[model samples]
Every structure is written in C-alpha cells, then in structure tokens.
Target chain A: MMSLRSFRDPVLVALSLVALWQVLHHIAGDSAITAPAPTLTHLWEMIGQARFLPHLRETGLAFLQALAIACGGGILIGVVLGGHRLTGEVAEPILVGLYSVPKITLYPVILLLFGLGMPAKVAFGALHGIIPVVLFTMNAVRNVNRTYLRTGRTMRLAPMQTAWFILIPATLPEIFTGLRIGFSLTLLGTMLGELFASQRGLGFLLMTAIELNDVKTILAIAVLISAFAVLCNAALLAVDTRLHRGAAPETSGK
Target chain B: MKKATWIRTVFLVGALGALEVACRSGAIPATMVTAPSAMVTTLVKTMQSDEIGGHIEQTLSAVAIAMALSITGGFAIGFILNWFPVLRRAFAPFLAAYYAIPHFAFYPLLIVIFGLGSTPLIVLATLFAMVAMIVATMTGLDRVPRVLLKTARIHRLSLLDEIWRVRLPAAAPHLLSGLKLAVAYSFIGVIAGEFILSTSGIGHEIAFAYDNFDNPRMYALILFVLAIVTAFNMTVYAYERRLMRRRGI
Candidate 1:
C-alpha cells in the first residue's frame, strides 16, 4: 500500500508525462521534440561541459546587479511617492499607464543605447523589475498604519527614525512580495536580452541551439533556466514567510 | 480637472522640456535619444501611411483570441480544481511555482511542434494568460464566503444555482483583476512570441527597426504600442471600479 503522506500528485503527474513522452517518441519516430530519457541524458552531458559555468555565471551576475538596482531604487522612489499625498495621487495613474507597456519593446532602445553587452542586459532587467517594486512599495508605504506614525511623532522621532523604525517594519511584508516578483521579472528581462542579441549567457546558448535545431540542448537549457527561477523564487518565498511570522498577518492582493 | 492634475502636467512637461533641451544641445547623443518632436512626426507619418495600423490589427486580433481561450480554459481548470480537493492539493505546489518559470523558455519547444507563424504565438499567449486567470479564478472562488454557501444550501439551492448565483458574483471582482492580468499577459506574450519567431506584427516591426538602427521609427512604434496597452488598462480599470462601486466594495 502507498503511504498517504508520501503520495504526491506531482510524482504521478511527472510519471504520466514521462510515459506520454515515451509514447510520443515511438509514434513520431525521430523528429523534433525528443523523448525525456535522451533529453535527460543530454542535460547531464551539457551540465558536465566547461561552457556551462561561464554562461550560468554571466546570467547570474547580470541578474544580481539588476536586482540590486531595482530593489534599492524602486524602494526609494516608492517611499517618496507613498509618503507624499499629492505626489502619489498625481503620479500613480501615470505610473500605472506606463507599467502596462511591455518592457520588452524597450529592449531595442536599450540595445541601441547600451549596445550588445552586459550593461544593456542589466538595464533591461532592472527596467523590467523596477516598476513592480515601485508599485508594491508605494502601496505598502501608503498602507502603513497611521497609529504607528502617531506614536513615532509622540516619541519625537526624527523623520529618518520614523521612516526606519515605523515605516520600514510595517511595510516589510508587502515590499518582500514586490522584491520576489521583481527578481523573477529581472531574470526574464536579462534572458530576453541574451536571447535577442547577446554573445554570451544561457539565453544565447538557447538561441544557438534553436538556430541549429538542436532540440535536446534547447530543452536542457530551458530546464536549467526553469530550475534556476524556481529555486530563486522558493528561496525568496521562504524568507517572506519567515518575515511575516511575527508581524500581524497582512492581506496580499494583486 | 484638479490641482494635483495640474501639478503632474507641469512636472511631465518640465521633464520633457529638459530632455528636449538635452537632445538638441548634444548633451545626449542624437543616435541614442530621439527628440519627442521627432517621435511625434514619425508617429503621425507612420499612422498616415497605415504602416503601424496593420501591425496593431494583427496584435489586437491575437490578443482577443488569446484572452478568450485563456479565460475559458482558466475557468474550466479552476472549477475542476474547486470541485476536487485531492486534485487541488496535488497540483497546488506546481501551480504556485509556475509563474516564476519564464514561459518563454517553452517557445523553442513550441517552435518544434508548431513550426512558426501565428499558431505558436497564440498558444503561448493563451498559456501565459491562462495561468494568471486560473490562479485568480481559484483564489476568487476559494474566497466565496462559507456563510453564503451555507445559506445557499439552507435555501435548498441546487449546486448549479449556488455556483451561478452566489459564487460567480462574489468572485467577480477578483476575476476581473485576473482578467486584467490575463489581458496584459496575453499582450506581452503575443508580442514576445512575435519578437522571437513571427514574420509579421508590431514586435517584428520593432525588431526590424532596431536591426536597421531606425531610432525614430523604433521610438514611434514603442510609443504606439504603449498607447494601446494604456488604453486597454484604463478601460479595464474603469470597468473594475464601476463593478466595485456596484458591489459596494
């Protein structure tokens, strides 16, 4: 008998997918969309290769640099806008309108400005991630309980002290969510840059595989990117959960 | 209309004026920064020739089909999950993590299957939009008050009646937000696919301009796309606001 706790539906789903892959492989008879077994084996081979680390490092470094900019700059802008009543009211709708525009369209402009290099990739990633961070930060800062501000004032806290002690703590939970989403978007933007016109990175590798019609390599790269994204997201989510533990539970809405 | 609006207008104008000055003065290189004046003329000329119009129509149609497919598909999936606790439990972890995985990575796989053109574009957009909708629909449905559900049962309402009357209306706001996201995601996904694979569409045109280093045309096209997206967002936001007011939310 199967143990109840150990019985994950995903395991069954994964097995079924593998079975489906085998069936498709037999039916299609050596075309594109290679079977899972070969793809898995190829993935291992690719991972063992020397070129993998450089591409991974390039992607990783660009993402980190961009994420850093987005978080710091986004939070600062968010705080200012959220702290000021008139400024927030005046700017919020315009920001929202701008946010609706796909960041990918600006990729061309970025390439033109920064050229085919790490700077372009970083800018693109930062641009993609920054908007969500600012929006979330603005909302979080705006929603900080008034009583806390009152208490800070009662204690005669300085403006910086009030922001540091009262505002940041209260807003941490929502801002964490923003950072998580922002990081995901940054990764996406960097990959898009790499795919579109970069000489290096996982995206470039994927593009190369596509050009060659190398299905196994393409699948392997995709798996690598997906795994990276999932791991980063999971790590951030764990941090977010931990941060929320002692704080009053906040309602997280879209 | 308001003092704040006036201030915002002034602020925007001031920024634009500064940028214009910088561009004209060669503080920023001409190749890197197209003047707003240049962008306006380029946009008007492009519109007059109907060069941008065709691309807009293509994108709009793709988005419409994608939105329809995703919403319908998402609702079906969401309802099924709601009806089956075991399925929801089994799939929750996977579904939760799905958003982080850049769906574009699957484009290669899609290309292998569909070959190219509009089919992969629509499918990818549909997939992207559908995930957001599914999550939204599930959350919205999950939030339907237990009290109202109990009341429906107390009133001897049938399952269909309870779902149609009580559940859907209660979930409308959440669903609308999901719809908003689906629309945006669909637009983004379709454009991305077109950028990566298509022979035609605004995304393809933008890439063409970029390849040729046509700054004016590139800026104009980006602006045109931005305007369309903003219009869609504003309309959805207005509709959602009206619904919220109706529901006294």
Candidate 2:
C-alpha cells in the first residue's frame, strides 16, 4: 500500500502538470501556447525531420566535449587543491563567488576570446559546469576519513595506489553528485550559447521559432529539451542515490 | 583581517595588474578585453552621461519585484506543502529536478502571455527564483526543533505567535540562505532574459555594445553588474557569518 501510494503520487503530479498545460493553452489561446497533445505530436514530427538531426548532433557534440573538460579539469584541480589545505582555502570563496554569478553576463567575453562557433559554446558550457564539480570534489577529498589515508600509508601503498584504492572509492559518491549538477548546468549554458549569435543547434531553432512567433515549434522544442534534461537527470539521480547509499554503511562503521 | 582574506585580496589585485599590463602592452588585444582601469573609467563616463541610468533602474526594479514575489510566494507554497505530507512527497522529485530544465525556453511563452517589456522579465525571474526559496523554506521548517513546539504548546501560545517566536528563530539560518539564493537567481533570471531579447536593461545594453564592437562600454557594464552582485553577496555572507557566530555555530 505504501509503495502503491508513492507510485500513484508521481503519476498524479504528472497528470496535473498536463492538465495545467491544457488549462494554460485554453487561457493563452492557440497562438500563445499549443496544447500538450499537439506539442508532443510536434515534438515527434521534429524528431523525425532530417534538418533537426544536425542541430541535435551539433548540440550533442558540444555538450559531450564540454562535459569532458568540466569533469576532467574539475577533478584534477579539485584533487590538487584539496590535497593542499591552503590552496583550497584561498580558492574556495572565489569558486563560490563564481558559482553564484550569472555567468550569462560573461558570454560575450567568452565569444570574444573563443570566437563564434563550437569552441565558444563548449567553453561556455565548461565554464558553467566546472566550478560546482571542483567545489564538490574538493570537499569530498577534504572530508575523506584520515584513517583511510593512514591505513594506506601503513600498508606502504604508493601515492597512485592509495588514490585508486582509498581516495576514489571514498569520494566517488559526492563527486558523482557534482557531475549530475554539472551536467544540467552545462546543458543550460550550451543552450544559452546557441540562443544568441549562433546559426545552428536546438537553441538556435528555439530562437528562430521565437522570432517567427511559431508557438507550436517553440513549445515542441522546449518540450524536447525538457524531456531530455529530465530523463538524464533522473538517471543520474538514481545512480547518485545508489552510490550514496552504498557509501553509507562504510562511512558509518568508521 | 584573516590570512586567507589578505592573500586572496593580493592574489586578485596581482591578477588584475597582470591583465592591465597585458592589455596595455598589446600582448592581449584591446578588441578582446580592455584593462580593468579602463573599464572603470568607461563605467564612470557612462554614468556621468546618465545614458544607462534608465536601463539600470529598469533592470534593478524588475529584479526587486521578482525577488519579493519569489520569497513571499515560495514561502507560502512551502509552508502549505509542509502541512500536507502527500503533496510534499509529490513535489519532491519535481523540485529536485527543477533546475535541470532550460527555463529560458519558456521566456518566449511568457513574452506571449505577459507581453513585452519588464512584465515578462519579472515573471521569468520570479519563476526562476521561487523554487530555491521553497526548498529552503521546507528544509528550514523541517529542522525546527520539536521541543520548541512542545514549549509553545505548554505556554498555550497562539499559532501565529509560536511561528513568529520559536519556529522562525529556529529556522532563520536556512531562510537566510534561501533569501541569498533568491536574490542571486533573481538577478540571473532578469539579466539573462534581458540579454536574450529585451528592449532595454543593462543586459540589453551589454548585448548591444557587444554587437556594435563597443568593447569598453560592454566591459564596463559587465564589470558593473558583476561588482554589484559580488558586493551584495558578500554583504549577505557577512550577515550569515554574524548570525552563525551569535548562535555559537
């Protein structure tokens, strides 16, 4: 009964969201917001179109490249900073400040540096994502139980061996959580990059639709992006939960 | 006062000095970035002309309105949700995943519904910001000590009085954090909306300047926005620290 209730609640919420969309459609009229059903249909049609695929591919490639840089650079920097106490202290506030700033303001500066193409988009996306990853990973590394490090030392483990066997497992859960957030923000940054001064991508499509006042297309594209973001986030969230849960017992025993 | 703060300040100043040198020496092209001092000079010049006063006023007012709406509305919704466990459960996943959505996608739809001008910008900022407050409110309320409520009951305090005196004080830290997030998100939302497609605002001015290759003006405006936000956030951070110190946390 408890499980049933849990399952039912989300379904109910989903239904209500659709109902709200329908009601909004009624109020705003066809020109403003397309109904949910038609928007979904439009999304399907968009997915089937050949021209849409290139934009998707463009966005996908940019996102992947950005994610790589963010994750790799963030982890490397985080590890170095975390391992050094003073460096972490000096960098922490700056990173937090950067995290809060509306990075969209810096988009033009990025464009100026990287030029108006894939490089700008990737750089923007990475800029959005890398901070949180570094912050989280730094904290994760700093919080790793001292005993584990001592144990590795007592066993005469090499630095690489200790990192691989002790550090990675301990910090993996928190680091993964950072990755999940970074993933979302990177997508947002990429889309924003495409929205302005760009010729191709999902964001460009949305921008064009806005300019044309093509309500159906705008709704369709939004729905598509939202669906993708939500699904990927959900998947990441599941893994995050599992990793944290798995880590709980080990941490508690210490 | 602290060692870290002194070091950070020196580091920042040094970095700025290096950039200034780079810009002045033509190692870094003026087309890419103006010197920090040049940006400040341009900002002062622009301010003296009063050309950007209206734009600044429009953007700040919209952000203020959005921040107010987000805080009040989010607290109300969160308070109500806290009362109903089932509703809160339903909302949990959605709230968790909320930031993942590219909310700017809805800007056009908002422009359609609310029409152009600051109305849509305020609405977008409000929507963008409200969720953070809601989450914070719920967490704050959830952490209010059970013993305080029991004491309120023992005193036979009125519901409003109990909330105001005991619950609110207990939850103040989380609420303050929520306020900080709401402020930041509001700025982001309004500025980003204006940057994307608005007629007037600091954001629009930056975009316009960028388009026209008015590098100094663009850098000045960006610098002004960043300076304002950083100062505001630092003030909040200082307040939070004072609060924590008073509580011996």
Top model number, DockQ: 2
| TM-score of candidate 1's A chain against the true A chain | 0.86
Tens-place lDDT per residue, model 2, B139-162, is 999989788899999999999999
lDDT of 1 by residue, B127-152 (tens): 98898888889999999988999999
- Candidate 1 is graded, for docking, as medium
- Collision pairs in model 1: none
**Candidate 2 — what's its lDDT?**
0.91
Q: Against the true structure, what is each candidate's TM-score? A: 0.88, 0.94
Candidate 2 stretches greater than 4 Å from native: A1-5, A151-161, A249-254, B142-162
Q: Pick the candidate with the highest TM-score.
A: 2
Cα RMSD, each candidate: 3.5, 2.3
List interface RMSDs for the candidates, in order: 2.5, 1.3
